[model samples]
Target: MKHLLTLSISIFFITLFPSYSQDQSDNDFKEEVKRIEQLTIKSIKLRQQINPEAEQEALNDEIKTLDATLLKKVTLFLNEYGWKSKKEIGELANMGLFLAIQHSSTEEMESFKDIIERAYEADKIEENSYALYIDRLKVRNDLPQIFGTQYYFDEKSASLRFNEIEDFKNVNKRRKKVGLAKIEKYAKQNNIALD
Candidate 1:
C-alpha cells in the first residue's frame, strides 16, 4: 500500500510539472516580446514629453514612476530570460531597453554591459546604437568619449561640438567604423561651424 501511494504521488508530480520543451520556451519568449513592445511604446512617449524647464512637474513625476517600474521589470526579465533574439522582439523593444538603461544608475548600466555587448555581437542592436551607449558610459565615468554622442554648444564662441574625446586624431575613423556620420556633417546639421 505504501509503495502504491509513492507511485501515485510521483505520477502526480510529473503530470503537474512536465519538462519544458524548446517549443515552450519559444512561446514564452514570444509572449514576453509582446509585453516588452507595449511597455516600450508607452515609456518612449512619456520620455519625449519630459521637459525639466517647463512647468510640467506632474509629467516629470509620471516619468520617474514609469522609469522605476520599467527598470525593475527590464532588469528582472534580462536576468531570468536573457536577451531574446532580434527576430523575436524586434528593434522597438530593443530601443525601449536602451532608453531604460539610459535612465538607470551607473551601476545598473555597468551591470548590463555584458548583455548589451552580446546583443551587439549577435547583430541584435545596430553599431551606431552600440556606440551611443559606449559614449554615454564614458561620459558618466568622466572618461574621454569614443563615439562623440554627447555634445554641447559653446555660447560664447557659438559652436556645437562634442566633449573631450579619447583620441581626437582618429575620431572620424572610429566614428565611421561605428556608422556615425562625420563630425563636420554632424556639426553642420546642428548649425555650428567647426573651427
Candidate 2:
C-alpha cells in the first residue's frame, strides 16, 4: 500500500512537471523567442490603434490567431527546455518567454506557473516580470497579491488601484527582494492613490 501510494504521488508530479531537455542551442532559443516577440509586438501595436478603426476587427482577429500560435510555441518550448535563466538566454529572450506566457489564457497562465518558477529559483528571471506574473495570478484568483504589480480601476476611487496586497505594510520589502520598485513608486507611476 505504501509503495502504491508513493508511486501514485510520483507519477502525479512527473505528469505535471515533465523533465526538461536542453536539446536546443542558445542561439536557436534566442531566435525563436524573437519570433514570438515579433508576433506579440504586432498584436500590441494593433491594439494601440497604429492602423485605422476600419482595420480593428481584422487586426483583432489576427491578434487572436497570433496569440494562439505563440501559446503553442511557448508550451512546446517550456515542456522541452523549461525556463532558462536570463544568463542562459539573455534579457530579451527571457522577457520574450514571459510575454508569451503572459498573453496566454488564464488556464495556461496557471498551468505554466511552475515551469516559469524555475527561472525565479535560479534568481535569473528578468526584472519585475516574475512579480507581475505572480500578482496577475493572485488578482485573478481574487486573492491579495504580494507585489503591487497588478492593478485595476477601482470604482470607489475612480482611478487605477493596485489589487489588495498580502501584508500590505511589508509589500515593499517583498518587492525589493524580487527586484521590483517600492510600492510607493510603483503606485505613483501607475497613477494609483496610496490613500
Candidate 3:
C-alpha cells in the first residue's frame, strides 16, 4: 500500500510540474503575440507617413520590446541574411520586395521592412545610419560605461578608442576591452560575424 501511494505521488508531481512549465512558456508566447499585434497596428497607421528616422524609431521600440531570447532570434535572422549592422536592415528595407522575401520567415521583420522600404521609396527619405549606430549603442550597453562616449574598436588601429581619442591612459586604460577573441566566441556561438 505504501509503495502504491509513493508511486502515485511521484507520478502526480511529475505530471503537474511539467504542465506548470508549459503554462509559463505559453504565457510568454502570448505576451509576444500581444507585442507583435501592437507593432502591427503602429506600422499600419504610420505606413504612409513614415520616414527613415521614424522607421528606425519603430525598430528601436521593437528591439526594446524583445526579450533576450527574441533578440537572439532577430540577431540570428539578421546573420542568416549576411547582414553586418543596422544599416543592412535599412538598406534591405530600401531594396523593397527582395528584402521582404528574404525575411519572410520572420513575420514582424518582414512586415517592418516592407513598410520602411515603401516609405523610403515614396518619400525619398534618408536618415542617419541609426540601425548600424544602434548596434554600436547596444554593444556599448553590454560593456562597462567607463569606456566613455564614442568608444569603439578601431580595427585599423588594433586598439579600442574612446571618443576621437585614440590614446587610453590612466582610468581610460582600465576600461575593459572587447577584443576579437570575445567577438569570435560570440560569432562561433551564433554562427554570425561580430562586424
Candidate 4:
C-alpha cells in the first residue's frame, strides 16, 4: 500500500512539472550553455581586438552628441559636485565608471578599463575619477536630461499622460530659430557643410 501511494505521488509530480523534466535534459542545458559561452567569448574578443584610435573616434562623436543634450545634465551633475567642461566631467564620469566595475559584466569591465586607459593617454583625466563617472552614468540612464538644447529639455515631464503630453505642443516655440544668418556665418567661417 505504501509503495502504491509513493508511486502515485511521483506520478503526480511528474505531470505537474513536465517543463522541469525537459529542462533537466542534458542536451537542452548543454546547448543553452554553449550559446551563452559563444556570445561571451565573442564579446571578450571584440573588446580586446578593437583599436584605441577607433574607440576614441567613436567617443568623440558621442561627446559631440552628448554636448548637444547630455552634457547639460552632466554639467548640472558636476555643478552639484563643482565641475565645468567635458574634460572635467570626463574625470567625474570615470569615478562613476570605477564603482560600476563591481556590478558590471566582464566585457563591460574591460570597456571601462579601456576608457580609463584612453583618458590617461590623452592626459585629460585621472584614472580614479574616470572609473567613477562611467559607473554613475550607467546607473543614471533613466534620469531625464535637464540641460542641452532647451527644446528637448522642455518636453520632459515628471510623468507623461495623454493630456500632459500636449504640454510639448509649444516646447520648441521659443527655441532659437536657426536660419541663413547663422548657417552662412557658421559655414563660411568654418569652410564646411553647405546648403
Candidate 5:
C-alpha cells in the first residue's frame, strides 16, 4: 500500500513539474520553428523537382497539404505569442515564421499586416521579405505596388513579369530606400523585361 501511494505521488509530481518549464517550452518553440523552416525549404524544392511549370495536379495537392500543415502550426504559435522579434526568437526561428506566413493564404497574410509592419520597423525581418509581403498586400487591395517585388505570369509572352507599380518613374528610389537594387538591375539579373 505504501509503495502504491509513493508511486501515485511520483506520477503526480511528474505531471506537475518539469514537463513544460518556461525554458523548455521556449526551446521547443525554437526547435519547432527551425523544423518549420526546413519543411518550407523542402516544400519549395519538391515543387521545383516535381514540376516547375505547375502542370502536375499531384504536385499541387502535395504542396497544398504541406502549406496547410505549416499554416496551422504557425497560426497556433502566432495566436499564443503574437509576433516575436528576431532578437526574441533568433534569426532561424524568425525565418521559419516568415516563410510560413508567406506561404499562407492571402487573407491570412493580410491579417498579420500590423505585426509585419512592427517587425519591419524593428528590423526583425529582412528587407526583401518585407518588401515582397507589402507589395503582395498592396496589390491585393488594388493599391499600386511600391517595391515591384510581386510578380505575375504574362500570359501573352508566357513569361514572369513584375506586377505594375505606382510611380514607376521613382520605383527605383523607393526600392533603394529599402536597400533593394535598382529595378533595371534587378530585372536584368532575373531576366525580366521592362516595359
Candidate 6:
C-alpha cells in the first residue's frame, strides 16, 4: 500500500513539474523582455545626447556601459532561448540586437546578422526591424544600404542624411514596401533637412 502511494505521488509530481518549470520560464522570459525594452530606450536617449564635444563624454561613457551590460544579457538570452521561442520576446530581442550592433566587433556583427536573418525567416521579427538590421550590417561593411534605415545628422550640411543607398531613385519604393516612412518624411521627423 505504501509503495502504491509513493508511485502515485511520484507520477503526479513528474507530470506537474514540467508545466511548472515552463510557466516559470515564460515569466522569466517576459521579465527579461521588459528589461531589454527599458535598457534599449535608455541607450538610445543617451546616444542622442552624445556629440563631438567633450561636454557629453560622461553621457557617452554611460551609453557604453549600458551597451555592454545589455549585450551580455542579450547574448545569454539568445544562447538559451534562441530566435524563435516567442513572438513578443523576439520583438523585444530586436531592441537588444540593435543596441548590440552599435557596439559589437565586426565578427560579432557577422554572427548577429545570421541570427537576425534566421529570426526574420521564421517570422519572429517584423520586416521593418529586419531591414534595419540588414542595412546596419551593410553600412558596417561599407556597402550601400538597401533599406535606408541608418542615418546620421550631418552637422556641416545641417541635415539628416541616410547612409549610402544602393539605389537612390528606388529607395523610397523599397522603404515603403517594408513599411518604412518615406525618406523625406523620415528625414524631417529625425530633424534632417533635405537639400
Compared with the true structure, what per-residue lDDT tens digits does model 5 show for residues 15-106?
87776686688887777667666776776686676633356887778888888887787778777776677778676667767877887777
Question: Which stretches in model 2 have alpha-carbon errors above 4 Å?
Answer: 1-31, 43-63, 155-157
Model 2 C-alpha lDDT per residue in residues 13-102, reported as the tens digit of each score = 776664333333656676776775676666567567634214367767877787788778767777767776667756655666787788
| Rank ordering of all candidates by lDDT, starting from the highest | 5, 1, 6, 2, 3, 4
Deviation in angstroms for 101 in model 3? 10
Which candidate would rank higher by lDDT, 4 or 6?
6
Query: Which digits, one per residue and each the tens of the lDDT, describe model 6 over residues 12-99?
Result: 9999999999999999977877777788778777777766424666776787788888888778778877764345565545666566
Q: Which stretches of candidate 3 lie over 4 Å from their true place?
A: 51-195
* Per-residue accuracy of model 3 over 89-149 as CA lDDT, tens digit each: 3433333222222223344443445444553444432332223222334343453332233
* C-alpha local distance difference test of each model: 0.78, 0.75, 0.40, 0.39, 0.79, 0.76
> How does residue 57 of candidate 3 score in lDDT?
76
- What candidate 6 gets wrong by more than 4 Å, as runs, is 48-55, 84-87, 90-94, 153-160, 193-195
TM-score of each: 0.75, 0.70, 0.28, 0.23, 0.79, 0.79
The superposed Cα distance between candidate 1 and the true structure at residue 18, in angstroms, equals: 4.1
lDDT of 4 by residue, 74-191 (tens): 2333334432223543433433323234234445445445545565567555433442344333434533222111111123442211212123333233122211133234345544
| Model 1 TM-score (2 dp) | 0.75
Off by over 4 Å in 4: 1-26, 55-195
Candidate 4 — worst ten consecutive residues by lDDT sum? 145-154
lDDT per residue for candidate 1 within 18-51, as digits (tens), equals: 5546568778776766777787888889878854
Which candidate has the top score in lDDT? 5
* Alpha carbon lDDT at 193, candidate 3: 26
TM value for model 3: 0.28
